[model samples]
Target: MSCIPLTQKSSDFLISSLSQVNPFNDTSSIIKWIEYKNNQRFEVNKIPLSKIENWYFEETTGNLRHQSGKFFSIEGIRVETNAGPIKQWSQPIINQPEIGVLGILTKKFNGILYFLMQAKMEPGNINKVQLSPTVQATKSNYSRVHKGKVTKYLEYFLDKSKSWVLLDQLQSEQGGRFLRKRNRNIIIEVPSNEDVPVYEDYCWLTLGQIKNLLQYDNIVNMDTRTVISCIYYNCNGNDRYDIDRVNECIHYSPLIEDSPSGYYLDILKSAMKKDEGLSGMDDIRSWSTNLKTKYYLDVNSIPLREVEKWRHDEFNIYHEDGTFFRVIGASIDTDKREVGSWCQPLIEQIESGVVGFITKKINGILHFLVQAKVEPGNFDILEMAPTVQCITGSYKNEKPENQPKYLDLFLNPDQSVVRYHALQSEEGGRFYKEQNDYWIIEAGDEFPVEQPENFVWMTLGQITEFVKHNNYVNVEARSLISCIGLI
Candidate 1:
C-alpha cells in the first residue's frame, strides 16, 4: 500500500469529521476500523519523500524505481548487470559514474489518483524508506496511545448509543479496563507479550471516552481535592495543595488518605469493592499512610501556646499594679456617663468615684446627667434616690451639696428626720426642711407624736392626703415617707 499525502483541505475535513463523531461514543467500532485500515500498510513508519518518489517512478517505468536505476557506466556506454539494463534508456545521463536512479510512482484506486517521486539512489542497492499511512486509521490510532483501554471501551459504548447502565454487565476481564477511583476516570491495562512489564505495554484510550465509561460505572462522586491530596502525597506532591482541590477529590474516590477517618471511609471502602481484583486493602492502607506522613502529621502536634508566642507577644490581662484591666467600649462610656467626651480629669473622676452620672430614661429620652454614686462591684449600681427613684437633670452641681435627699436615707440609716421636705426655696434654691420645724396645719392633731424607730415623719397635711389616697393607713403612710422629698 502507498502513503497518501495530506493537503490542508483534506486534513481539515478529516479533523472536522472526527470531531463530529463523539469520541465518547462507540470506541470499539473506531478501534476496529483502525485495526482494519492499519493492516493494509506494509510497514508502520511515517512516509518520507524518497518512498513517494520511488513509488511514482515504479508506476511510470513498469518496474520498481530502484530496479531500473543506473549502474557504474564506463566512458559513455550504458552498463549492463545480471538483472538487465543497469540504467533505463529514458533516464537522463549524468557525469558521475555512480549516479543513481531518479523516477516517480503513480497509482489510481476507486477514482482517486496518488503520486510519489524517488530521488537519485545507487543501482542494485535495496533502499530503506519510511512510509506514511495512506489511510486515516493509522494516524487516529497513534493519537489514542495515551488514552488507555478503559477509555476506548467507553467510547465503544457511547458510539453504540448505550447508557452507563450497560457498563455494569461488562466485567473487567484480563487486560481489560481499570477505573481510577479517585479521578472517576478509566484506564485500560493491556497485557504485554514482550519482555517489558505488563503495566508499560498498556495502551490508553481517549480521556473523553474514559469519562463516559466512568459515568456508566456510576463513579460520579469524584472530588478534586481528595484526588489532589492523594496525588500530592501518594503520587509525588508536585502540585500545590489547597482546600478547594482537596475537597473535590474527597467528593469522588476514597483512595485519598487525607480525608477524615470516619463514616466516609466506610462508604468509600464499600464502593471500592466493585473493582475488587485491581488493588487490595493493604495497598490502599500503605498509600494512605504515606499521605498522612507527608501532609498532616504536623497539624496535630504543634501546641497552641507555642504558635501564639511565635506569632506575637502575649496579650496582657493585668495592669502593672495587678489590678485587672478591661477594654471598655467607647459607646458605653459616652452614652452612660458623658465623661468620655470631657478631658482626662472627667474620665478619671468617673472611674475613681470622685464624679459619676446615673443613666436614666425620662419621657422616653435617655438622660446621662443624673448624679449617682457607683458601687464597687462587677456591676456599677447607680444610687439615685436611696431606693432608686428616677431623677431629672444633670446633678453635677448638687453632688457637692451633700444634702440628705431621699437617697441619703440608705447612706445614713439612723438619721432621725425622716419626714424632711426637699423643697426648692425662693431664697436657698433647694434645702431639706424638717416637718417638725414647719407649721403643723393638721386636719386632726391626734396623730401619734412618738418617732418610729425606722420611720420618716410626715406632716399632718401629708398624712391626711395619704389617707385620702390609700386603702391602708400604715402602708400608705410608710410609702409616702419613703419618697418624702423625691418629687
Candidate 2:
C-alpha cells in the first residue's frame, strides 16, 4: 500500500470521528471487556529496593540498575533553571535513554476507519487494565532482552513493508520524573483486504467509539491518548493536500447526524479554522524560539548518594518534605504480560496534581491558553505546556503570587464554564498509581485576551500542528487534548 495523502487522511478522520458504530464491538461491550480483563490473574506487591532480584546499586554512584544493564535506571541529577522561583534542586530521575514505540493500527471497514486497541495490563495501573495502543513496547521488551514472548504486531511498526505510516513523530514524556525521555508516537493503516489477526484481548473500534470512551475516566491509557492526540483534522493550503474537497466528500453525509452539537461543535469549528487563531503559526514559533533563547537551564548527572536534601533508605529514596515523588521497588506477578513476573523500580507520586487548559474565544474562534515551560529534563529546555500544570499539594502553603499562573481559575471555577473534567492516570508501566485532575475550563466573556510573557493563546488546530513535530508540546497537554469530546 502506498502512503495515504494528508487530505484523504483528514477526510477519513472526520468520517470516523462522526461514526460510533462499527462491525466489531460497541462502547458498552468495550467497557465490559476491560472490566473482565481487570479480573484476570495479576499480582503486584511492594518490595524493598534492596531486595529486588537481578538489580543492584553501584558501589561508587549508588545508582540502581538491572543486572544486564539493558533497561532503565534510577539516578540523581542536579537542576538549575531561571524560570521558576527555586533556582536549584536535586532529585532522582528515571534515565531511560532508549526511545520506545507507542503505535496504533488502523483498517478501513465499510469505508470507515476502525482502530485496533488492546486491553493491556500494566504493573502500576490503579484499575489494573485500560485500553492502550496496539503496540506499546520498550526496546528491551521488543528485543527480548528478558527472553520472553515476542511483542505481537511490532513488525508493522519496525518494517515499512508491512504497513503505510499515517502519522509519526517523536514525543516527550513527563519532564519532572523522566530525564530526556521520549517515545515514537505513530499510527499506520493496513490494506483493507489484509487478514490481520485480532488477539482475544484486542478489538476494533471506530474513532468515535474511542472518543466516547475518553469521556469516561481512566478507560483509555496514556499511550493511547498521546497517539490519538496526533490525529489531525485541518488542511492548510497545499497543492498536494486540499481541505475543501475533503470536506465536500463527507460534508452532508448522514454519518454526522449524531455528531456533537453544543460546546463540542464549537471545538470542531475551532479545530477546522486554522487561519482565524489569535496568533499565526509563525508568531507562535517565534515566541517559542525566543523563550528557548531567553531561558537558562543547566543540568548535570550526579551520584544518587550526593543528591542533597533527599534520604536514601533501604526500602525507598525520598525527599525530606515528601511532596514531589519517590523511587521504590515493586515485585509484579502476572501471566497477561510479555514476561510472566519481574522485579523493577518504579516512581510513585506522593501528591495529586492538576493539569488543565483555559480556553476562550478569540475572533470568534476557540483558543487555548498555553505556557512555554522550561524543565531540566526537556530535550529542548522549553515546550508548550498547559495553562496550569503543577502538584496542588506542593503549593498549599505557597503564596498566591508564587503559584502557577491561572491555577486559581480551575480551583474556583463556575459550573457553567467547565467544559471537560476528569481524573486521568499517567503511564502505568512506569508510574505507580499516579493520577491527575485533568480539566478544560472555558473562560468567561470577562476573561482578558492579554497573558503573561511566558504564555500565549492557540487553537486546537494550531496545537495539533505543533504536536506533529518533536518536543513542542508536553505530554500533560497531549493527555488533556486526547479527552476532547467530539460526540
Candidate 3:
C-alpha cells in the first residue's frame, strides 16, 4: 500500500525473522529432499518419434494438425486467431483437463496470524525451490502413483467438518498460454493452540516476514504471492480507517508507519476485496462486465514471421536474434496428472526478464507511469502495461528501437527508488522453464517526467479503479500491483 523506505526497526525484524529459519534461506536442500521422495517410483521418459503412436504430422509441413484419444480428441487452434475454427499446432495439447490445488494453511498465534509455508521444489523453477503453499497439489500430487497417500495436512483443508476455511475460489490459467489448467485456491485457519505438523522443509512465517521475502527474486513462488495478494484487510469486516486502527495492523506488516497515505491506502485496501476471493484474470463479474463495456480481445493470428516488429526462426520468435525468447516444444509426462501430461510448444525466454513500474508523486498525488503495449498473446489489442517489461539485455541490444522505456531508472537506482526488488515470475508450466524479474521503482515529487503518446501517469486510486476492469492493466503490470508490491 506504501512505497516508503523500511525503518531501522522494520529492517532488523525482517533480518532476524529470516535468520530464525536459516535452512530455508537457499532451497537447494529442500529441492533435493523433494526429488529424493519423488524418484522412488515416478519417472519421465523422453519418447522418440518412433515410439509415439496415434499421432501423425501433415506431410506438407511436418506439423501435428490434429490428434485424438480412444474416447475423445479436440482440435486446437492458435489462441490469437479469432476467426478460425480450432486448428492444431506443432506441439500436442493435453487431452485431459489438469487440476491444480493451492492451499494456504494459517493459524493465529498470540493474537497474530502466521502462515505455514514449505520450501517447495518445482521442475520449472529458476531457483530450484521457493516458499510455496503448505499444500500445492496438482493432479499428479493425489494420483494413483502416490497410492492414496493424502498430501500432508491436505485432509484438514478438504475436511469441512475439521477446519475453518477463510477463502476459496476457482481461478483460470492463461488460456492463450497454458493448456486447459485450473486451480482451486484455498485458505484455512486452524486453532491457535492446536498442534499442527511441521516438517523439516517447512516453517511458520508472519505476513511481515512473508513481505520481506518478496524483496528477493524467486524466493517466494508465484502461487504463494498470488494467494497472499488475495488476502485483504477489508475482508475482516471491521473496515475502519482511524489512525489507531492502522497502528494496530502494523504488527501484520514490518513496514511500520502511521498516518501515511491514510485515507487512500484504506480505499485501496477495500477496493481489492471480493466476496469471491482470489483470482487470476477476470473473475470479478463486475470487473469483467465493465471491461467489456468498451473493448475485448479481437484476436487474429498471422504467421510468426509476419507479426510486425518481430523476427522468428524456424524454432523461435524473437525481438532480435533470440534475445528475448525461443519457441520450443516438449513431450511432458507427469503420469499422475489428470491427462497424465502431454507435449506442447511453449515460450522459453532467452534469459530471465524483468517487469517494472516507476512511480512518482507529482503535485501531491502518486502517479504511475504506464505504457500502452501490444503483445502477441495479449487479450486486448493494447493495454496499460508496465513502463519497462523486457529481458535484461533487451535495452542493451543492437536493435535501437527495441529498447525498453524507463529501463535506466530500474537498472541504475539512485535516491529515486524508495523500494525495488527483482521478484520471481510464475511457474514454467506454460513458460517452459522460465522466470521473470519484477521491479517497482518509486520516485517522489523530485523525479521529472516526459509523457509520450502511448504513455500516461495515473494515481493509485485511478489505477485501482482500472484494475477492477480486465486487460486494462496487463499481467506484468497487474501482478506487480496485485501483490503487496505496489506504491
* lDDT (C-alpha, whole model) for all candidates: 0.20, 0.87, 0.52
The model with the greatest TM-score is 2
Candidate 3 colliding pairs: 76-87, 77-87
lDDT by residue for model 3 over 1-487, one digit each (tens)? Answer: 1121223222232222322233333334444554554453323333443233444443543333224422112222233322212222222222335567788887655444567887655545554456788888766555533244457776776675656665566543433343444466676777777799887667777655566567655677777764654443432233232334344444445433322244345334333333212221233334434434433344443333333444434444444544545545446554333344555444566776767877665543455677765443444445566787767864563454545656767766774353456657676444555777677667765566667656666654355445534455555665565444322
Backbone clashes, each candidate? 50, 0, 2
Error of 1 at 176 (Å): 30
Deviation from native of the Cα of residue 163 in model 3, angstroms? 3.4
Candidate 2: global Cα-lDDT? 0.87
Candidate 1 yields a Cα-based lDDT of 0.20
Candidate 2: the clashing residue pairs are none
RMSD of candidate 3 to the truth, in angstroms, is 9.0
- Which rank order by lDDT, best down to worst? 2, 3, 1
How well does candidate 3 score on lDDT at residue 436? 71
lDDT, residue 204, candidate 1: 23
Off by over 4 Å in 2: 235-251, 254-257
